[model samples]
Target: MLTALRLLACRRAPRLPDIAPVGHVVGCLSPTLLTSLASGHAWAGRLPSSCRVRVPLGDLQCVVYSVYAPLQPSTLSSTSTGPADFDGRAFLNFGTSAQLGFLTSEPPQQPSVRDHAGIDCFPFFSPDRYVLLAASLNGGNVLAEFRPNSGRLARAANRTAVSVRDCLAAVATKPASASDPDPLISPTLLDERCGGGTQGGSVLGLRMSSCRSLGRLYRSVCLGLINNLLSLCPPAALRQAGIDRIILAGSALRRNAVLRRAAALRFDECQFQSIVLEDGGARQQPAVADGAAGLAAQFLDWVAAGRGES
Candidate 1:
């Protein structure tokens, strides 16, 4: 990657002339694909069936790709140096898997790759801007499956289902339900966990306290993941970049009151406004995919007008 970047930098003596505009611009976002034959620094490569890149871009390609970050959905009118609200901004694609990043006017200085558990952090962007990004393998998909009815119910309920399992291990020993149960549990201990236990008749009551407890656990796991990612994004960097808002997107947040509450509290604590993407009369996954497609369309428009990289 470094070699390719160096080659690109050294090869160019004078700036390239403004490439003629093609018929249209090609735009895309994570988890969705759009395709076109025309190619240029301002336009993205062929779109994929999914929003993600099944084939990772080479370093040179990444450098070129960074040019598109500023053209993301919410930043259309944003100046090249910074948005009006701040010097930079962040977009958190909150989904079954989550990605958080900041848009910058320059390519990042360091190689952006790191691993926290199974999640991957890296840089993605077009030439005029960089996206400092971190992605998690865990997302709302696990939370959805964690429900008692899901096929992966056992796995989802397991302490190991989340990255913060160790943190909850000591606390999980408390019965899923008990009169003297932990505060996290509700008054009624009867729920699915009561099956085959000494409380034979408790399950008959159908008290949802146990289910609520499970939901709390899932929410905690989600919060931990988000918090961990935020911690990795240095405060100094955010302040320097003037990040004032956080835009959250994905299906994981739909019908997820707990996760949304946690995020609101955390962002408030950090003095940042949090904007939850609307459901748009659909589930979170479809809404996210549709949003990506819409953004891609706008991006293509932005590029075709010669508003992209110089």
Candidate 2:
């Protein structure tokens, strides 16, 4: 990726006249920044100074949550000349790793929090990691089966040809009744990375009717995931940073209406407005790529106006 970026910086193509040099190219490594840019919060000259953005991107191993906030003037070093100095953006990344011990039965220690350009950043851990395990236990692939078919399930609610994800969402979203009791699925999963010896995840309250119900199982998984996420970056902290809107961008939240709806319902209690990138009325396939392109365009404009010339 770096090599490709370097080549694009050094070699200017006739078709693309606004390509910035390598020195001027700003790399966006955080999902928070990407989601902020994709959601139209960041611009060439109008970067927000007092907004917070929360982004959760699901990776193969775990789900990563990135919270972006403007840099506090007090945190800036006199000699530092980094991108954060220019754009006033700083982010905290929390990865759902088993080592964090968030899923342990015992009360876990407080995650080490760092001050990053004013925003409080926490150590990495994967709270949503169990969702993947639950999917695997149910004999379904989370990435392949759940993510890909999420769009179909979200768009066409009445479609007959439902995917595994659709079925899970349907069952998960239904109101609980006497016939359907909620299952309890532990988010903890044992991994080599964990500090102490721990067992894998467990399922409880398995009734004859609910044992085979994937939705109930997944509902517990989703609740666990979202709750873990909120524990890391609570709405009170976001509001303290003057963030009223949260832009949800990621394969998991963007494609899965189930996850999106769950997240919306959960965050609604905090009174924070949420925006799903996929449901923005306009189609934004590959949102990160579009955001990167938009940033490049902004950089070109910034350079043309005697800024970002270094």
Candidate 3:
């Protein structure tokens, strides 16, 4: 197994073209895959036992785990001076032996609140302003709710499902239950009477940095799907695909706690594995496994191509 990367850095560089950071960008695993990875010995970790939840970075709708690292300092001396001054660090990548490193300092204590647990300041969105959000990591069942109205998360109704799971096919359980209150944020909320004119809608949802309205469409289905995602998908199924790994911006996930628990559940038949490409990029076995790289590359390519249409 390869050690996870520690990409600690500070400051921004014009030479390093700004990349857009889309929320819930990809489903790095499937529920089944998650289960498989959890069975591996290398899946163990020193994750904070208790995580206080917090609102996600976007939409103010997401629920995530909040970790508090004791003695963790905010500022530290930089070890390298390439373009920015940063004290980078590495941690864990659920169920895998690889380290999850980012371009930031690894303090002795976790932050009381973390907008993003898996990743932060995505190069794509940090300076470039490309925001994306996904709801599931199941390769077959995934959706990318395009940010139609600025940075807010696209409600279940408006979100576009990608290669979603077969179970997600039951998308018509409820028909917009409009009278029930779309409690979650939606396009209609942007209306004047909705109290969202100047407040910036969901302060966190604005992470996308695009105010392009996708217009009203068949969004009721989204509500139904959300129900299914929360209810239908079994725990074992989530285990298979590396459940909860796929994060939706503003999604109310339990953070690293769920990930840690997932590993403790079972992990004998599984093993952590990774392969390095000639380009230096690595592919994990249990989590993203076989074709994740190819799938991701193609997905990004399509996104790049779609820009021409808009």
Candidate 4:
């Protein structure tokens, strides 16, 4: 009887605002779309209602969408409800595939890949002006190595773990990055084959070669990953933009202590703060559904505020 009542209540719950007109739809933007936009192609498909833009990009017009629309406003930390220049925030979706982004009033016109020490970082903008970091590595695999497991995934994890540890030990003697005060523990080692600098491979190569046991690699790769992401946003840029709030989302982030620590270590300073999103007993919903729902609500609010203007 209790379950039945709960089900009924769920059904009766109010729906989010309507974004698209009847028969129109919105869905996840594919990687092809991202590639096209990066290549300066015009938008070709159905238009999303809220948090999307079709603006001029040089000679071509492009469309961009927000990836973190599923996160609720309440999940935001110390951000002003009113629009302001420095009130922007950064949201990191830590998952099997992790993503990092910044939320602001205007999406970047042209996105570029940045280099931090030896790591390559790609930044993209969502419909809501959230700039996301698109990674080439499997975040889940990294985590698998961070935690102890007893199966196939564990083996792959071990391989990456050793590489990462060796890379860290090598950089330990080098000069630290300008942004961080700690030694050079980073994910560049995991991507060694993809062009990590010689420093990452040569420094600890000899020492790590003798130590083959996975037991020696204890620190989680999450730290390196988060540190690299934060490096994308330098302190001056963050302070100038007023983006102090950090939102850490993803099932992985909620369950993993190492990931949480990584986030706290990098963001818990005077200039930056972080707030975690709690599911709070809500029924599990797909990220797409949550994002679409939020878009609908924003659309309704926009329409209402316009005095019923279309």
lDDT of 1: 0.46
- Runs of candidate 3 with Cα error greater than 4 angstroms are 1-79, 82-103, 114-140, 144-310
lDDT of each: 0.46, 0.40, 0.25, 0.46
Clashing pairs in 4: 51-127, 65-126, 65-127, 66-126, 66-127, 86-241, 86-242, 101-131
What does candidate 2 score in Cα RMSD to the true structure? 14.5
Residues 1-310, candidate 3: write the lDDT tens digits.
1332322222332457344333323223444545665565565342222322211133111111111011121221111222322222111222201112222322213232122232222222122221111222221112233223212334454565432222222222323233433233222221222122343222123212122322212222233233223222333333332323322212111122222222222121223221111223432222222223332343345457663111
lDDT of 4: 0.46
Error of 2 at 17 (Å): 29
Q: Give Cα distance to truth, residue 185, candidate 1, Å.
A: 14
TM-score of each: 0.46, 0.46, 0.16, 0.47
**Over 4 Å off in model 2, which ranges?**
1-162, 176-181, 188-209, 278-280, 283-286
Candidate 4: tens digits of C-alpha lDDT, residues 148-261: 442333447556444443443443333323442333345544453334445331112223422343222323255566755555545445555455776766666666555666
The alpha-carbon lDDT assigned to residue 63 of candidate 2 equals 24
Q: What does the lDDT read for residue 292 in candidate 2?
A: 39
TM-score: model 3 vs. ground truth: 0.16
Off by over 4 Å in 1: 1-87, 110-125, 149-212, 234-236, 277-310
lDDT of 1 by residue, 1-310 (tens): 9999998998876667444322222333444223333335355664444442222223322322222323343443322344323234565555666556665555345433222222233433222434556544445554544443432454566734644333234333432333623122111222122123333111223345535454445444555656645644544455555677776655555455556665666677888787654346543332433434444564556567776432
Give the clashing pairs for model 2: 95-125, 96-125, 96-126, 97-125, 97-126
